[model samples]
Target: MSDQATLEVRNLQTHFFTKAGVVKAVDDVSFSVGKGKILGLVGESGSGKTVTGFSILGLVDEPGRVVGGEILYRGENLVGASQERMRQLRGNNIAMIFQDPMMTLNPVLRIDTQMIEAIKAHQKVSDDEARQRCRDALGQVGIPAPEERLKSYPHQFSGGMRQRVAIAIALLNKPELIVADEPTTALDVTIQGQILYEVQKLCAETGTAMIWITHDLSVVAGLADEVAVMYAGRVVESGEVDGVLDAPQHPYTAGLIGSVPSRNARGKRLQQIPGMTPSLLNLPVGCAFKTRCSYSTPVCEAAPVLSEVAGGRQVRCHHPLATEAV
Candidate 1:
């Protein structure tokens, strides 16, 4: 990323100290989101994408911990930061939108109550002032009748509306970096599109960097400037969204792109990766993706470091596909 990057995760490794052994939930992950740029972290379930987001926010709970590497937020190392310091940054400078609306909302409390407390948690603003900010936030996310909605409880709103409220709270602080974990996955197509548009617009208008975590390629296609593809616990491919999606450097990435329904022939069977993702606890000796890649060679028996290819794209594969051929 450029000097204006809001977050730079370098060789991040978050592990779970299980009774069986240490599980490398996120291993050697690295990426950066520059100011106003959206970077999509795309992968299947259990690919460690969510863990990466939690590690960034210092939310990894007991039995799980950030084991190695640096999580640099605007050149400041967060790996060793104290809880108070992280709390100070959580809502003021960094905010996260969870996958579930209930994770953010209190079922019993009115929307106004939760949102006002959130604003007051980090800022010394009058309740009236904070309430107005909350009202504007709801309006920003396209919620109609903000004042009426603020009086409603969490159960009063639809799933989409609840999600919008959560997003509004995340933005209420005008954070520098927002880590959103599949924020639109639960919404309908129409609602998701509207939310995506609002999010993209907000980032551009506010110059806030974001890391959008999701398994959906289509969402990233329309919203992200850059994308990082993860397999198992590592980033297998990363580059500009168009370049990587159009001519995927890694076989796993190509597989993911091919599997997307819209990209395939209407009557043709969908393409699928050959095998299941390897268990992180007992990952293969070398390239974690080797077991599922038909293009794997003997070189793949040894772990491949994330190396740069043409056009500054990075791929963790001994045999990256030829861009011209793709």
Candidate 2:
């Protein structure tokens, strides 16, 4: 609600009910993103990063629901808003760029059709005005010959170009908040760099807030203003990007930083966090990460609450290492 933050998600719990059991995809996850800034949400696959984003947008479907917690946009709870209101908010006040461009682009429809529809769906505008805006959006994301490309179908564009078009649609609205789930993953490294630059420029120019979800630490280190690390569906550490990455408090966080290619110590085999992420359906009773933690002890066997550590950083580890602690 304060002027500093654009979106604040607190203790968000999203669960999926299935025949196997209840899967706590997102459990007690909390973080805040300030205006005109990028908050990187990083974790291994199936760590609930994507679901958290979907939950914030109210995109979670049947058998899966946001069971508890508050998603505050400008300090207002969006948890129980009606579908109509939510629809109005989406693509207008807020937007999302999915990992797969096909999620946003209709395969059978021409690019122009989808772009114009996205624009006019939330505003009253003539075809000419909408078309102009659509063209501009496409050009903004660096699509070549955007006017001609607009007449083409999704299948006609290369994977990277399609992703750029999808990003353009998200930027067209100049949305105040955007949740981008691995938006650059499909693009080539060169294209990915360009998109990152475009995203940063868009956020700076529009004062838009963003939560960019990715598992690549290098991506976060490059583009994000702040970083939040998630494990077992919960945030284990969060802080200013430099502070958390340079000197991580939690063992898990240190491991993540170590696993990055740049930080690979010479002659020391590349460090990696051993063991797969725990299954949400059958999460361990103790600290979910205690099983793999090098510094874990009897105290770590109990659940650790995300408490404020030094420098406004929040960490959830009972036996966090002081050597790396903020």
Point out the worst 10-residue segment of candidate 1 by lDDT.
262-271
Question: What is candidate 2's local distance difference test score?
Answer: 0.88
Collision pairs in model 1: none
C-alpha lDDT score of every prediction, in listed order: 0.93, 0.88
RMSD of each: 1.4, 1.6
Query: Per-residue alpha-carbon lDDT of model 2 for 1-326, expressed as tens digits?
Result: 25758899999999999999999999999999988999999999999999999998899987999999999988778898889878888988789999976566888899999899888889999999998898998899888888899999999988888898988888777799999999988778998998999899989998999999999899999999999999989999998998888888888989988787654366777879988899999888778998888888898667889888887788888876684444
Which residue ranges in model 2 land beyond 4 Å of their true spot?
A: 1-4, 263-268, 323-326
What TM-score goes with each of the models? 0.97, 0.96
> Residue 308, candidate 2: how far off, in angstroms?
0.7
Q: Please, what are the lDDT tens digits per residue for candidate 1 over residues 123-200?
A: 899989999999999999999999999999999899999999999999999999999999988888999999999999
Candidate 2 residue-pair clash tally: 0
The prediction achieving the highest TM-score against the true structure is 1
TM-score, candidate number 1: 0.97
lDDT for position 251 in model 1: 92
